[model samples]
Target: MVFEYAPAPESRSAVDIAPSYGLFVDGEFTEAAGGRTFTTVSPSTEEVLSEVALGGAEDVDRAVRAAGRAFEKWSALPGRERAKYLFRIARILQERSRELAVLETLDNGKPIRETRDVDLPQVAAHFFYYAGWADKLEHAGFGPDPRPLGVAGQVIPWNFPLLMLAWKVAPALAAGNTVVLKPAETTPLSALFFADVCRRAGLPRGVVNIVTGAGETGAELVAHPGVAKVAFTGSTGVGRSIARSVAGTDKKLTLELGGKGANIVFDDAPVDQAVEGIVNGIFFNQGHVCCAGSRLLVQESVHDEVLDALRRRMELLRVGDPLDKNTDIGAVNSAEQLERIRSLADAGEAEGAQRWAPACELPERGYWFAPTLFTGVTQAHRIAREEVFGPVLSVLTFRTPDEAVAKANNTPYGLSAGVWTEKGSRILWMADRLRAGVVWANTFNKFDPTSPFGGYKESGFGREGGRHGLEAYLDV
Candidate 1:
């Protein structure tokens, strides 16, 4: 049965774009300490989205200090009281859900259907779930009287802006810690709007501060001595830098980084369901997903049949304005990202692989790339080895389960992997051998507030969901 939700008033009329540059610090929004700002562009049309504050190292210090001061009192609050603030913030998010969705689509260029239905609802669910756990830490297996880190430094990625904010901030607050969160430089709007939501919820001043800037600002936040915890979700290279910066510090750290996951198919699997899972694993969110299943490993017997079905499905994908509910694939996050995807695709072709894309016309204004596939990709090809992070897939075949496992674990990343098989024994067998944090049997990219999601090895560490999330913010 199809589910219908209430419609919201559209935001088509051009409101005067605010001077997008400002820091949310100490219960107020203020200009950057160095009085500098930078232009933010809409990835869809390459138009100037707005000017955002370019915060400096000093600005980060100020944000951290504010969080630290707030933490002293916040940590002393009863867990039930802390949970009340989180519940209030969740309610406000639900009230302003449409506005936030539209802002996310405009800034991040994701499909409206996804931002509205998938991202926003999950964002609220995350807060609500974590809020309920606030006063129940004793039963959460964290031992008696778990303690909160004083102040948390959280940096999120561009893919799911508001949702990532909710994921990082919700649990931190629920666990009795204050946070100075930083959104990606390109997608700071939702984080700023989230600050407004916190204010409307009457959350305590300095309990959650948002400072906007690029890599330098993030480096400063991680390196600052006052921050008691650091949580980041982005590329693996940046995760390494953060790990190094926090090496000797007493702060707790959690990193959610890059992924090049495998979606394996056995001959007895249900083909139609597997096809849907494959589409969702990579193409959903325009393949900007960190846990995107870029590698398709099909058992040698049904390889041809599965590829044919996937090709037909790929042709039906709709690519257009992100605001359209019908859009299936939206623009690449930015021109830089489009170029990166294009370059890697070129490498695939140059390295003797067959490349194919659906015959679809993209809007001339936005940064768009059609859903793409490269078959005949060997392990040596750059496309097979690297994280494309776009609407691209590399197809390969394997003869045995051992070969499948070996090929799947070839990459340095161990974030996620999927298996499609009718045999229960094989499912358990593969799950045990797969060197990934999240393993899906007959499914891919499934998320739950109760499931712990993170990576292993170079993909990054520390779980983000489930009762385990409190570990990152607590003194265990």
Candidate 2:
């Protein structure tokens, strides 16, 4: 089964990158106050890609004010007219998908295949799906004459830059709210490119604004008096801070935070099929997913066979240049993220879980970690409890469905969970008992534009996709 394959690297020429980029505010690219800038590097090779203007508190203020100005007209426009603009944006996204895919791979160190197939399509679909909801808001169960929230301050993480932007912005705009978004510092280029997409769509001047910077800019944007609603997707700690900061304010808040999701497998589960779901659950996007199935709760009876199949599959995964067409796992997003993965993994080993990884050659330069698994893991083990947020799976065995539920629900996160049993009763029974917002049967990591997704407990509150997402940007 060992077959040699030729290289199939995607061309980088599809998208052009300037030496430097400025903040996108009020339909213009403006320099940062005092000309502050930061270099964004390609994680695959640690190459300096471009210097982006660093926005400060003043820039956040500027962007929020612009969004406030645009809100009056954007909200007043008929929903059908607004839908036309959203439709235009979706069409443009489809047309430029290839270029945006290549740029995303270069900037975020994700495989071009994933960027092309998964992220870009979903980004476009969110817009198209939300556009359909624009003129039909009354039937959405939000009452007959729901109103827009005026201005939304959104902050997205780097894992899936363009898609997360689409998740927040599309629904907000469809609900007639203007937005000021801050993309993660490491992967800011694609969001900047999106600003251009907005301009080409003839979206009103201040309808969508992007400020580039680190934490300070996001803090300012969320706390700005002009911003009436706040949406954020990032680490749990940061989400907590945001909740505290906006505690007594009139601003509406929605946070999509961290998770340590569990994937449960019963003795009767289909072994090969479950193996694939398990792999996709933890290894997709190098397990940068917040709701990734990082914890595996397998029945003790079939544990050995499942682990063997999973290890063999992991061995075949190609880990190298993100531009390469066949790469399954690309580079870690940054040195910081790579170190965090390593530290948590080492803790797993030190805590006495048996660590196993497929034998593979990682690239000489760049942040890389082999697909890894840990057996002999328990609820007390760090790997089993903590959100590794990398391509690492912690395997813990359970004897019964009750034990599986207990172990899965032990964590503080209640974001997502998966069940891999063939029995219809078992899937429904477990779904009810599982404390997660999303429960998948037979498959894991399946997402749709129409499904409302959010979490309980520390995983943060509110829904992001589907009709429910409109609530975040609407004033009922």
Candidate 3:
């Protein structure tokens, strides 16, 4: 006899999505300067979610100027006072988290469980954590005095819309910098909703402006003469462009870019625990995470055992509605992203790697890809070197710890890596030599507000969390 668990989806009525939205500048929602617009669709069912204003160069300039005007007064405000506003935003975020989580799932095509449990909670904690530093900046060890870097131009990607916004906005505000932020075109709703949360918290005008558009708008913001600081989180190619645009300017730039993380397992690793880590590393958020462990390096002695356990575990992962509480995998962010993942996976197969995915039926509508693994993947394989940014893992075998390090460090990205082992000495030995910014001993994809997170080389520069993150917005 077979038993099936009934589908349990979150109530959509908990959140209300507007038919249309405009650019949020100077604390007011208004039409774009050129009156252009774009449509955002729910990837789950190919349904139109909202029509939003398409911000152009003129609109970007206006938003940047507004931020510039607000910066003087905002920066002059007492640190203790700024802390109050940050604290209020944190409280309001916690109160409205459920609503925001549902909306994020709809717009971003991620499970509500992740938005609720991981993204939303961390977003609030970021604000609260930075708020505590507002009045204590002098002791943060930067110097006796540090000043805000005027208007900050921030660009965030769609994978974790609201959370990315919080990462950039909360700290900028805490450091007394006004901002003109642009959310990705596909997932702008949650950031727009965040604009309301700021208003409800009574944040000052232009203190946190959000503009919605594609690459053009972001370019204009990054190149704007009025912006003194720029923070971006997205692809590496775009980050390079922004770096060049701000080269001769006085803007302080920080970028958190792409990553191809490696999860290494030793022969002595606990089979059950390593298998779970392997799943969480590559499959979390459909593998959209920048520091996701997309490459799996297993000891040759235990390669077959790990793969067998991983395959059994993949079969148990439920992939379907983003709102379903039981769904482990959700729709890819968009047609373009899905295509990118597909193309990369195809390259893996064509390059002589063995592809394997569990026999599972995906939903009829929406963009979806099953959790997959490529065996016989070598260091030269595209799947091993490139950041697929999907629920895909490429497995490679290594005989020694030195060989594992060599394979892991071969990529241009140095964002993150994980090691699963019982011996404490081996974990430390691995951690010290790994080039990644954050190394996890027994876990992957775990984050905390108090920890500093960033990468080396092409994976981007400057950290986003902890006390170190605040320095990006300050003038030491």
Candidate 4:
């Protein structure tokens, strides 16, 4: 008999959703000048969450002007004083973490466990980590006196909305730059909620502004003359466009873009542990991660062994509502994303790859895709080469360590990779050879505030965490 879990849903009452949200500029929530609005929905239930004001070029200009105006006072404040404000923000985030997590799960459709444990904690930790750096930037190895860029224009993706906000805003503020930030169109509620946190922390008016809209609004912010710096975390296509838009200009720019990360398993790897790592690497956040290990490379000698174990593990994953604490995989963030995953998976089958997914029931009301994998994939297949950005894995096999390294670094992206082996020396050897920004020896999806995370080559440039993250915002 198959065992089933009892329904356990996290209470949505933890958060009070507003009927409508406005663009946050000059420390106030104001309606867009164009009077445009868009509805945000709960992807888990297809219920309308709220209507958010759609920012236009005018709104972007207003936000950039506000950030520029606030830069003078904000940059002149003592580092210790600036640190105090960040500390308050961190404490407030901790105090209200449950509320933020519930709201994030509702908006982003990530599992409640991830929104609560991974996203919310990282958001608060990022603030706390950067808070300490604010008072110590002078001694931070960037010379005796690192200066702040006047104003930073930032754009973050929808995958990890609030955590990405923390990644951008925390370091920018710690470096003493004011900011005009744009959260992704699909997930703007947490950013709106964070504006409330800033108000509660008594943050200076205009120090941070959120202008909400789609690509056009983000383009305006990136191209705005008042912005002294630009930080973007999104698709490589968009990142390349921003790089060109800021070309021949004085704007300091940084981008954290997409990846088709490789998770390689060797014959000597701990089979059980490697299976778990493989699952987490690709399936975490419904695989809506920029650095997700979407490609699995196994040693040909142990290919069958690892594949069998992986199939067994995939069968055990519970896929369903984001609010259910027991859910292992949740709904795709939107209908558009579901369609993308479907198209890519279909291509895998048409290209003569073997596709596999466990028997799992899906809710009818929301965007859902079963956890899927494709074997017999070649390097030239679209599924193997492209970034699906969903819960789909492409499996390949190699005969030797050198072949594995060659296959891993064959992609245009170099965001992250994983090597599963018991030999410490082999792990170091593989790590040194991989071109990725981050490499996990045995584990996967591990993150910390102190570690620097970013990509190389076409994956985009500049780091987003640790002391290195500060350099992007400073006038070093």
List the lowest-lDDT window of 10 residues for candidate 4. Answer: 135-144
lDDT of 1 by residue, 177-260 (tens): 999998998889889888888999888899999999999999999899999899999999999999988898798999999999
Residues 301-371, candidate 3, lDDT per residue (tens digit)?
99999999999999889899999998889999999999999999999999999999998889999999999
lDDT of 3 at 177: 95
Q: Give lDDT per model, in order.
A: 0.90, 0.94, 0.93, 0.95
Clashes in candidate 4: how many?
0
For every model shown, the clashing-pair count is 1, 0, 0, 0
lDDT (C-alpha) at residue 87 in model 1: 90
Instruction: Kindly report which residue pairs in candidate 1 clash with one another.
Output: 21-53
Residue by residue across 396-429, what tens digits does model 2's lDDT show?
A: 9999899999999999999999999989999999
TM-score, prediction 4: 0.99
Better of 2 and 3 by lDDT: 2
Lowest summed lDDT across 10 adjacent residues in model 2 is found at 380-389
* Models, CA RMSD each: 3.0, 0.8, 0.8, 0.8
Q: What is candidate 3's TM-score against the reference? A: 0.99
In model 2, the clashing pairs are none
Write the number of the candidate with greater TM-score, choosing between 1 and 4: 4
